[model samples]
Target: MKFLATCPKGLEPLLVDELTALGAEEVKQTASGAEFSGSLESAYAACLWSRLANRVLMPVTEAVVETAEQLYAAVQEVDWSEHLDQSGSLSVNFTGSTKSINHTHFASLKVKDAIVDQFRDRFNCRPSVDRDQPDLRVHAHIYRGRLVVSIDLSGESLHRRDYRTESGAAPIKENLAAALLYRAQWPKCATEYPSVLDPMCGSGTILIEAALMKADVAPGLLRSEHGFERWKQHDAQLWQTLLDNAQQRREAGLASLEPVFFGSDIDTKVLNMARANAERAGLSAFITFERRDVKDMAPPNEAGGLLVTNPPYGERLGESSALMFLYRGIGDALKSRFGGWRAAIFTGNPDLCQAVGLKTDRVYKLKNGPIDSQLFLYTLYRKSAEQLAQAEESESQELSEQAQMFANRLKKNLKAMRKWVKQNDIDCYRLYDADIPEFAVAVDLYGDWVHVQEYAPPKSVDKVRAFDRIKDVMAAIPEVLEVPLSRVVLKQRKRQTGTNQYEKQGAKGKFFEVGEAGCRLRVNLHDYLDTGVFLDHRPVRRMIQQEAAGKDFLNLFCYTATASVHAAVGGAKTTTSVDMSATYLQWAMKNMAANGFSDKHQHFIQSDCLVWLKKQRKPQFDLIFMDPPTFSNSKRMQDVLDVQRDHVELIRLAMRLLRPEGKLIFSNNYRRFKMDYEALAMFDVTEISAQTIDPDFKRNTRIHSAFEVRWP
Candidate 1:
């Protein structure tokens, strides 16, 4: 007979392996489940021994079902007498749908009517509908107009091992915990390490599952009932024999099992619940539950073991900052206390995994309910106290030759810009822009904090050497800049395509204020690739302030609306900011409000600049500042934007909105940009790229290209 074993979506391969090990034949993988041919005894063994399956089903019949009548007729063709008696109770679980049969509940009603009508005609009576504790549970599935019905052999998804009566918030399902352990190779680790630990164990699901596997206890034995128990075809004698064998094996396995298990949680109430769960599972003696934080976690015994945990993944905004410290503490505790051990961490937020600071040996992708998650495995080596001290001392020692060269260059640039910085009262400026070819990075000073962006090296560069150079730069920055290591934020800068640059890097939601040209702007160093304020555009903002007085101003592609804020502070009559990103527009409003420009005249519009500009038919602005990205294929835009190819059209549209004699300041950061002089022969255009470069950015004259477009 053909049997179908249903499990979580990502565990189909594991389930196939499990069913084959249980004496199944012709095992095949399917979406969210697996299929195989097996005997009645093999099915029974799978229910008792398989730890990953949610439900084991036996197919009864299949047919082409397009309408409700066909579905009813197909279900009625099955031999009702062989499956259930007239006096028994039954339930039908319907899934999937077709074009003609769109409602699952209506389809289930038709199937139920067919089954009862057949029984009533044959014996003058019908089985009653019992959703709970039914003698027979029929499952109907429709896919692409084909319907296949089956009998649910193992009733309530096997994840409910029946041992967890109390659970905490967002507890992991029992079978998923088993799958994580399998991915971590916990069974192999148990033999070599002779121990297991969960630092954030809630309700002891992982711990109890580990104990059941180690003690050779059948997961099905703990259940009070099964779907096959009340069926007409149940074999009492064969099932009793299997149960007897499982009992004997359980006793023998428990006797020989010697590995210890430990679980801890910060909540006292959850720890109590975990202990109660272990006691109910009959493994309280083998496992220990304690109330403790992850920072204080230590090994239970002298023998190092496997440390597995499902730490909280910050699902909410602003929660990642705290979780970063939590993950770091977990890494620190593992390195200091649980040396010579293997570790596994399961989390939904993969980006936060970098905070752990350990190199992962293996990674497995799985799903926790609807959230896509990952399981990272690592091997931790023992570090003595003396070795840790020596490492710390070495980190603080003298810089290498290349590092000293980078430091001396930074010092020279700072010395050159000291007069300019003081005369302008600047609190943020570019300190370096890849001045040295070997050390390719951009360093900017935002008040006292430093932001360093390491540009991606070319393919010809050795990756290891480039990585070492990055390390040297990081060490040299704090020492040469006279700042604490904690205040220096480092980021990797890659060539962005499409809208990749706008995607968030972290959920810290940490924003700080920095003054520039007499304007206070909010900037976040950790959460985004670019801080809220663009330091390279300081000269442009200053020019806008100088030229704006009682004039209607327009800022296009106004990221964070910093330019708009400068215009409003410069006494512009009204300011309008436009961008596609709602996040940046909101930030722009905050910047305007911080500068006391929250009046109705200060408008922040969220729209694609191209689409918004094309819709305007009147020229209303006196001064317009348009700074667009060099390339963008954002889905929100109606068309792709390549400044070189589209600049002529963009300029025409902005000029249409420009009043007579008004100026349009246009700029882009594409170094290879060329002017389409013939296309814009109707308007007077002059290149102002040289005038826009400040003393701080004189080293890289091509940092940006600027133009002043005006009507003749």
Candidate 2:
């Protein structure tokens, strides 16, 4: 008889070895499973003792199938009475697709119809379909033009070990946990150390699987059901003998089990779940569950053992920054505590894996549900005090010359900005802006935190070299700027279009307050590419404050209402802020309330500035400030905005709202922006860009262009 043993992806080779050990012949590996030819005892043993296999399938028949007619004919070829009678229930699982049969549901229905029609033709009645607990489960796979059908020998997936009644959020599947243990060589390590631990063990999946492996207990013994129980060919006598042997082995194995297992989680609720699950698995005496954080995890005994854990991967955007600190803490704990032991960390985010700051001996790619994950294995070896000091010295000396130069330049820039920042009581300012052409990054200081944005390199630059330079920048920032790794937030700045700039990078929802120009502004460093406050606009906001007293102020494109807050603080009679983003408008309201300016006199309008200006018929403001993006094609706008081409029309609309004596200050960050002076000859427009460059932004003089427009 030929059979197939199915498992998760990346565990096929292990399944092949397992099947071969269980008295199977010609065991060959395939995608997500293994195929072999064996006797009934061998097949039954695979369904009983195989830990990695998800299901044991016995092939009934196969045929060339292309259309629905061909599929029905193929399934009808199998004798219906030989496997399942008219009184039994059956289920069909169909996978893969062809051009003729595109949907799995349609294909499965055809197979079911063929079997039922055959049974009706032989007898007077047909079997009913039972999806939940079928007496016989038929598995079919179609690829290209071939169909292979088999009987599912294991009713449920092998991962359902029947032990876990409750699980925590994003629990690792049992089969994947077993695969990780196999990759970490836990079977061999158990004989040597006789101990195991999981710092982030939710529901105790890994620890329970490890205990089963070490105790010589069959993974399927706990399950009360199997697919072969109701089949016509099931051997009750042979199965009972195998079951008796398994029962005896489990009893003896538990009595002599010497290995100790420990599991811990920061969440007390998950720890409780783990305890309940262990109790159900009948291994509660060998395992200990504790409520402990990863940072506080230590060795359970003086004897070192294997430490395996699956940490959260921060699946949401904007979460990696916070998770980086968690990964760093895990690394610190492993280094400080678990010396002369082996450790395996599983995660879906490989970038977060680098935060561990440990070199891996092996990395195995596996799937955790839909996520492509990796198991990073490390051999922890403790260093002597003198060796640690020498290692630190060696690390500093290993810096590339380019990195050393970047560090020195950062020190130089900080020295130049210190006195200016202190004298002006500045809480946020630009510290460095691409001073070294090779190192193109903008470093800004927001109070005590540092925000770094790396300018996207040109296509002409090699990607490898560009990434290396970025690494150099990251390494130098914390050392030269005197900040911790967690305080340094790094982002890559690229040319954005179609509201991409406003898109979220993470979901941290963390905002900090920074004082600027006598106004408190809320800024988020992780969630978005650009922080709430623009440092180069310090002088621009200051100018708005000086000219805003006793005048009705209108702010266009009022992102986060930073400029409106400045104008309101400058004693504007009424401030009306307009923008197309409700998110930013809400943020604008928060900024107003943060400054204790929540009266009805201050309005936040959520609309395109162009459309809002077109609806106004009379002069309603004495002072106006408009700072538009270079290009926008957002769907909410009636039309696209190109600053250079649309400025004349945009400014014309704003001037209609301005009084005859009112001043309209316009600014944009387009580097090559050209004003339509010939088109707007009715207004006197003087360029005030140079005057808006504060001490901090002096080097980047063309960072923005500002103009003062008035009646000629």
Candidate 3:
């Protein structure tokens, strides 16, 4: 039988892992679901034992349909009277995606009409649609241009693990909650390591799942009916044998599992709710619950245990700013209170994650209902430096295996981060601050070049920790370049509202490598993010250097005029740098002045770049460097601009300033941007994305793209 298991956006891998373990064959992954071929017994096992699955659906038919008329015809063509009884009550559920037929309700109605009308035409009777508890629940998924109909294997969401009656605000679903633990390589922590604990165990979903899992209790055992029980194909004897086999398997697991479970929550009423839920699931004997704040937490006599918690995100719980404080307390408690144990935390907000100082080992993307959430995995065990060195030195090791056990703890958190970065189109943004103990490397990949700067966190978690991280991030570039300390100038960045003013400037003291083997360069230090030149533009700068021979160069919005300096160094006859900041122009002058250039060769214009470009009526330059701020509306400048909206016009205006066959090099950090190829049809545009972004920004390209445009 072909089955579909729908999952959250980021957890397809975990769900696939779960199904594969449960003996489901031909299991394949999907964006929001998994498709697999399995027997009825396999389906039952998935519901009974598998975790991380949202819904198990049995496929009834696969068809292609173009319109509502075609949808009814395809659904009716499936021989409705074969499996469904004419007298049996049933329900039709339709999920429509991008296709000619889009309305789910209307599509469902058409399917229902086809089934009932087909039955009326043949058997002289029709099954009525049951919206409540139906004998058979039909699910029609319209993806692209095809429709696949399936029957719900479980009556409700399998996450209703039947273990907890106690409900709290923002409680995780049962299956997803359990899947979190089972998918984690905690088994290597060994089965008998210690107790399972939840620091923020509101209503005890995690605790209950932990308890049932340890006891080897079938999640299905707690439920009276499964949707399969009503199916015409449901074999009573086969189901009985499957249950008998499952019970026997549980017996083996039960003998190995020790009764070690703990749960803590701030609310007294929630603890009571957890207890009630535990009792309903026959799990009261296996689980322990306490009313205690997460800040002052300790793992009971169980040493080297597991601590799982779901902290409040302001989005669902309305906790407000105090949540940050709460997160910091969580970090402190994890580091100080529970050093020997593992900790996994789930939260919707990443900023709050900054407060929890523990190094997340793995992060996973999990859904807590409709809201996107992260499950961060942090290993409690700390190996000595010697051990870390040995691990790193081992050449035969696979990165995945070593990180696998550690990864789950942080996988969910990483998934959360990945989604955020993808959404904001900032895949190149910083993932972790060095102040985080679990964090060591300031890793930013631009295109292909990966820029990694390693550092240790300060003992104190105050302003100095974050402040020191900024210094470390700034110090990284020069260290990678092997530049001297004398050549670098450190510029102090002012408090800009949009940018993180607290973070130190990127440019530091300049370094001149006497005979550097790779990319011999002069770098500038001081002021804002422009370090003599942007490292992200290594390739673009190189392109300018190549095209600079005998050309007149235009650098617009050119802070520090590094590109102009490069153009001059590349043998350009005349190079002009236009910017609103005179200080940057002077700094640009110093860069050129150091390279032995004077006012006679290089021109500096301190004017609004946009306005200056508008005033230039005649084309003069053979090359132009155009890199704009993502979005800005300055009081000093007359116009407000955004990269997403103004890119075309900016390119249009910039090209007018370029002489015939002159190149206009444009760059922006918005990753998901689509350039208006239609509007810019007058010029030839080629993407130099891979070339422009250095290794430091490669984790996500489209983090920035470099485009070259010239008249045909």
Instruction: Name the best candidate (by TM-score).
Output: 2
Q: Which scores better on TM-score, 1 or 2? A: 2
For model 1 the local lDDT of residue 480 reads 88
Residues 389-408 of candidate 2: C-alpha lDDT, one tens digit per residue:
77557655755889999999
TM-score, candidate 2, is: 0.79
Error of 3 at 131 (Å): 2.0
Lowest lDDT 10-residue stretch of candidate 1: 316-325
Better of 2 and 3 by TM-score: 2
Query: How high is the CA lDDT of each candidate model?
Result: 0.88, 0.88, 0.69
Query: Can you list the residue pairs that collide in candidate 1?
Result: none
lDDT of each residue in 523-578, candidate 1, tens digit only? 99988788998777888899999898899999999999999989988999999999
Candidate 3 residue lDDT tens string, 311-341 = 8776411132235557876776666556567
Write down the TM-score of every candidate.
Answer: 0.74, 0.79, 0.54
lDDT of 3 at 133: 77
Poorest 10 consecutive residues by lDDT, candidate 2? 315-324
Q: Clash number for every model? A: 0, 4, 42
